[model samples]
Target: MEVKRVRALAQRALIRRWAEDLGSPSAGLATVEAIRSHLSRWVERRHGTFSFRLTQVLTGHGCLGRYLHRIARREMTSSCHECGAPSDTALHTLIEFSAWGPQRHSLAAFVGGDLSLPSVINAMIDSERCWKEMVLFCENVMTQKEAAERERENSTADPLRRRGPGRRRLRYGHLLLPP
Candidate 1:
């Protein structure tokens, strides 16, 4: 087979594998599911500069309390620290958290009504202004959340309760070396 054709076949297979993974109920990729709804192909490119805060809001993989609780038990509860919601997931933080009411209202205006992840994403894709508005909202909320997290860590008197900035994971009872 030609090299170009071979590469195309490989790419298709990879995309198919990713789609299967994303669809699996066991995969637990709720945020990725939101992005998948907007994609034309399994691996379409989005136009825009990437920002950490925006990615966190879209992916639910960052400093969000639910994610933090799940990943490393860094948080005592998955509830929103600001509003005490059941889960501090990305959707909750962006759309439901009362603390971000002002910013959410601003973003909703650009999104054209009540905000859903898909609506936020659609608005972002349709207009650069909307994209900026969403990013700004994510930054504003995430920054405050992060600052509060840091303050909590610093104020705690227990040394064991304080978290280190570096990440460490145990692998078979041994610490994995940081890359």
Candidate 2:
């Protein structure tokens, strides 16, 4: 049993080391670096959990659309549903999407528009208003993107509809009437 435990621990350590080594060399990997910077300071919090759970999204890459899609295998492409940009990355959602321009401006003003991950994290730690604005901006973008995806799905003719129109979809835990 002791030998088995030692073997398991050794394998885990090896896998971790290999993963870290392969973590880099991708094109346009600044977003990953920025996320790392935020996480590096996670333990030494300059402020308490300000905006609450939303801050977790800001600190990790896995919360981004690309990672989520990749994990779920929902679609072949990880492109932004709004703009069709490649791999709706965290940086792209936060910095590049023109759809959120107005909200970005508001959040940017609070955080001084640095747009760096550490800066945003620091701003959240430093001010509750900044934390709130950041959370609102991120949440707004996600909500808009999800709404757009729903619109796309609804617009596309369901193959079953060709069989005839007695189709219903569940919305808000209730059945939606057919058009």
Candidate 3:
């Protein structure tokens, strides 16, 4: 029957033989064309595209390699000033860190309380999850420092502002009746 013929053709041994023949250096033009056509069809069906943030973090700003080096603890030009841990890699820093554990936990909570690092990265790279958390991990240290500076400036300036003529002050003896 036709079913039996199809089953026999689909057998592993037959498929291996066909693959070997096609992969052989002496494969014919027809075999090469068939392989190319199959690959094209597979690509079309998959519809794959590169993740944007992944590309940026990995290559755009040199963060990926720097992070990797830090994690590995190999002699690097610089290390994370906050934790003093030799920043190994971006993945390791994000996933495995004693100091950053709390921040990572917070981020995981934001993303439905799942702390899987790969999942977090996938979400970040796809731009569908809280990727800002990752950005904060790298850049928000400066933000915190700036905030502290602003607070210090405001505290120092408060007394001066209170004493300036622009601020109206009422003396206890200056009470007057409404006209």
Tens-digit lDDT track for model 3 on 1-179? 99988876677456566556656544234324434334323233332344444333333223333432443222233344345555434444456656657776777765556545445544454453365665555454324423543554466644421223322335533455666
Off by over 4 Å in 2: 1-65, 156-179
Residue 54 shift from truth in candidate 3, angstroms:
8.0
Q: Name the best candidate (by lDDT).
A: 1
Query: How well is each residue in 106-137 modelled by candidate 2, as lDDT tens digits?
Result: 98999997977768867876677887788887
Rank order by TM-score, top first? 1, 2, 3
Tens-place lDDT per residue, model 1, 118-177, is: 777777777778889989998998899889888887888865447755533332335545
Using all chains and alpha carbons, the TM-scores for the candidates as numbered come to 0.75, 0.57, 0.32
Clashes of each: 0, 0, 10
lDDT score, candidate 3: 0.45
Candidate 1 wrongly placed segments (more than 4 Å): 1-21, 25-28, 41-46, 165-179
**Stretches of candidate 3 exceeding 4 Å from the true structure:** 1-87, 115-117, 125-129, 141-179
